[model samples]
Target: MNKSLKHLSRNLLHGVLETLWIWRDERVAARLGWYLAVATNRMPAKYLICRRTPVDVELDAGEDELWSAHREAAKVFEETFGAVRSGELRLRELQRPAKSLMDLKVELVKRMLRHCNFCRWNCRVDRGEGAKRGTCMLDKVSRVSTYFHHLGEELPIRGLRGSGTIFFTSCNMRCGFCQNGDISKDKDNGMVVDPALLAMMMWELRVEGCHNINLVGGEPTIHLHTIVEAISLLGSVQPSRDKLVYLWMMKPDALSWRRLEPAQYLYEGELNAPILWNSNMFMSLETLEILRELVDIWLPDFKFGSNACSIKLARTPWYWETVSRNHKIIYDWGEDIVIRHLVMPNHVECCTKRVLSWISDNMPDVPVNVMDQYHPDCFADPLSPDYDPKYSEIARRPTREEILEAYRFARRLGLVFESISLEKSVFGLRP
Candidate 1:
């Protein structure tokens, strides 16, 4: 079911059931159904909005106009579940023989930049088109600690505008809870450029209209040749348009799967959007067999259903059998994968019912977003001997009935691709 997600599976299931009639009401689906039932559960503790201030002075202005009218009624429920106003979807079918989510997202970003091994310091960093730095110190240029246009994310990545992120700074896995730990533990001299000015910043985020181009954070597969020279200079200056671009990677290993071979040499025959990796699924199985041929959205990040908080948050040590064998190779490569699971305030029912109920008994129709946006930022180390959050108390915040009991365990794990919010579960702490 790849060929452009089988032509938008009945328009994204009627745009997520017409986003409950463009959010007619029901307190934005019971405040995003208590953060989508513990973010689909594997339990890392969930819920947060235990409030101490902010959240626009505690939900006013008519709950921020029902959270921007449930995000424009969930983009008219993905334009009636599956959206496609002409960004074409026949992403590969000429004589049909399968394999063509734009040639498996440019042969999975040029086979993760020809065997990149993205992060974990395996730095096989060649990044094609002449090499540079690696060991997560990053060099082949992709620097730029920030970019913008991020209307909060999710909802099929901020549709009616915003989602063109960027970030990229430098990290392989230093997490102590790194809420952008000052440019992922900055050593300075980053923001470097020139790869045709990073493909004119992805054609200036598609001429600032932005809807997708999010290649985020200090670990973009340790700079796969500046992300294949800014997606090969925005697919040769919009060779035929239809090239949205949205990558988010966070290390899945094996020379960052050879940077998905420059998205099929820059949007091979056009219509190329969705290649997000946003990892932490931990790797090998030959980097999930090179992300089943150049991903198209596998956001990954199951944090922990408890290997005692995935060996204490990302220090690794096989965190829950490598995020359940790379979430069953991203649910046997399908269901436009999303699963994000971060609710962290007191471990949402053991990280959402034992790791989102073992990813809803093996990818029950993939979609689980369930993030409670943790905070306690910039984790100060203070001579780390191991774990600290300044002498616990579970570092404060996270209770709204423990994020609605991790959103009623994502509807008892039947999980129909749930998403949640309750004002992004606050968490800016620091008093």
Candidate 2:
């Protein structure tokens, strides 16, 4: 086959395999079923659902009492979700809570800004005052490097349309081989956007038929307040009549669109895109507590196996403990998640093997994407002026043998890796 034909055939095969895997794997289906429902408008997004689940605590409640209320609210959310999933109740039937969990989260996250522990770095700088900046190099405002329908994600995430990706500026970790170094390292690279504008970006992507609102950046954990607030605003903004007409016109297949009056559509203001939290998995437990109620899916990266490697390569301390702890917490919560472990050059034994082993032992049922797309960039690029001999070990792409070995190891551990693993031909390896 010609190169173009070969590429098309490969994509077709991958799509078929992705569908088959989702159908065959009950665990994967159970984990991602809610996300798929929200994407197709069969159910409301978690954030929208959160708006209807009340928290009894007052804004002035003590921190410990507030956390206790938060936990109770999470149980309520679970019960609500169960009803919705089982068709026992419709989303429209859900009464708005007096004080919603989302509202409480918004307030709590804002309070956290006073002594920012959003990420594990614990910079403790008062970001709300703008007097000091955290290790992420971001202050009160969150910057958007770009927002668009990104087609280059995993199968279920992108779907037929694409994943609505919003790239936030600045990251907590300083990975030497960072792919998005320009946006990640430069705090001034993108336009600063408040929660309102950020919400609109999400609205636009939903209108354009994107699957999930993919919140990524150098790292999104640092901008918890902005993200939670944006989600809240997205649920309340009633689009104009013209926009509703446009939305209906764009989605001709929407059967219920005709049944609802234009006025009804205006007042029912809710965005139905699943909140996909794409992050480095270095967030604090407090941040994770808030996100548990909002985020529909977690796209966390398991970057390093050892703290030594993480500290040396990504300038992140306590990599193993932090990432592993976070992963286990999310898993124990029964959250929908897909873990990505990038196969780096010459670090397969120290990183890839260890990460896969941990996942197999702990989260074997969770879908994992053993990525082979790592390439030298940023400071690791020899051609870049920033390159140093000290980072020479990861200055090249992973060998085909290394990629194959990683896949083989994942397979040995019985990990659900086929859903997002690269094709054999991509690595020039035998199947």
Candidate 3:
């Protein structure tokens, strides 16, 4: 592993890969590249990470960590989210008037803004006056990058009509390999719409015949006040399932559903659609509590189990403790949670193993979406002068060996998959 020897080996391997390129099959070329990298010992240093073999992976959980979501399902989760039930979860539960609900949400969100403990950073700065800020870079509120009917989500979410997606601007945990770099990194790349406008956007999406209203962002939890306010507004305007279905029946055909007649579905000015909180689980209890009633699906990224991986890629100083605690919180809530873990290049051992191990032990019933569509985008690809030596480990793509190892490890650990569509997507389609 000496530097001079490594350099010599890599040059010889590169020659072989160049010679093999004439065949012109991507998988074959990729496989050839991987074999060369392994033979040359050019794999990322982090990828070589080792852990003490577990006596029993099933037994490693903290006394409560092994507590499965299935066992806790009926007991832990309140019926608050169901249309028939009402509690502190819903405005109707408090017997508050619809207008009062919005007022109460605004009042509470303002208080939260006074000392923001929303994201994992928990930077308790006062943002009430729209003058101060935190790591998230927000002054007082949230904004939108865009809103549209997106077909590129999981099956249950996207379905036929596509998920109604609202992309919030900026992020808390800005990953180095973030695909949405244009919006996540730039604070000013998106529109500066307020909470009320966000609510209106949801209603508009419903009218457009989207399946669910999904909220995604660089990280949405950072905009606590505005998000909660918008959720409050969304709740007030939500029509019953029966109403939503009746309106849909009037549509002539599926093709006509996309360009919908809003007037037909605007009963009482209320709308109905499941709400999806597409988030990185680096959020605090305070924020989760605020949206528990309104958010129907928990679409979260349990990205890294190793602090080294997170710190190196996302610069999040406390990703492991923060995300793990948050995962436990989600499990305890007993809600519908679909955890997403994008298999990063050369990250199988250092990141994937621990993440899968933790999930297998903790939320056994929770479905994991093992995504293999991780490309070396953004800073991770080393496209230019900004590329740091530290990131050189992950600059190349992950090999077939590592990808298979991730799947094998998950299977061996008895981890339940949310979907097996990642591989299909890996080759460019989920069908």
Every model's TM-score: 0.29, 0.87, 0.70
> Could you give candidate 1's per-residue lDDT for residues 1-431 as a string of tens digits?
78767546643322122232313433333323312221211111010100000121112234334344333433432332222212333222223223212222233344455446654444555656435655465434456655655667765555334555666776666666666767766835345655555555554553444434566565455554455445534534531222223222211121211222222222334323333556665554544543333333456667678676655654555567756876786566332455677777777767767877887787765666676667555452434444476425345456778867887777777675443333243452211
By TM-score, the candidates rank as: 2, 3, 1
Clashing pairs in 2: none
C-alpha lDDT values of all predictions? 0.48, 0.81, 0.61
Report the Cα RMSD per candidate.
19.6, 6.2, 18.0
Better of 1 and 2 by TM-score: 2
Candidate 2 wrong stretches, greater than 4 Å: 1-27, 238-269, 423-431
Model 3: worst 10 consecutive residues (lDDT sum): 44-53
How many clashes in each candidate? 60, 0, 4
Give the better candidate number (1 or 2) by lDDT: 2
In model 1, the runs with Cα more than 4 Å from the true position are 1-167, 170-176, 179-182, 185-189, 193-196, 200-214, 218-233, 237-274, 277-335, 342-351, 354-364, 367-382, 385-431
Q: In TM-score terms, which candidate is top?
A: 2
Q: Tens digit of lDDT per residue, candidate 2, span 1-431?
A: 99877766654433212343344556567667777666666667888778899999997887778788988998999999889778898778989878999888988888889899998999899998888888887789888887766778887787645677888999999999999999999988887777877787677666656678999988888889999999999845645666545333433343321122222112245557789999999999999999987888899999898999999999989779999999999999888899999999999999999999999889888889899899999999999999977789999999999999998999899888775665334553322
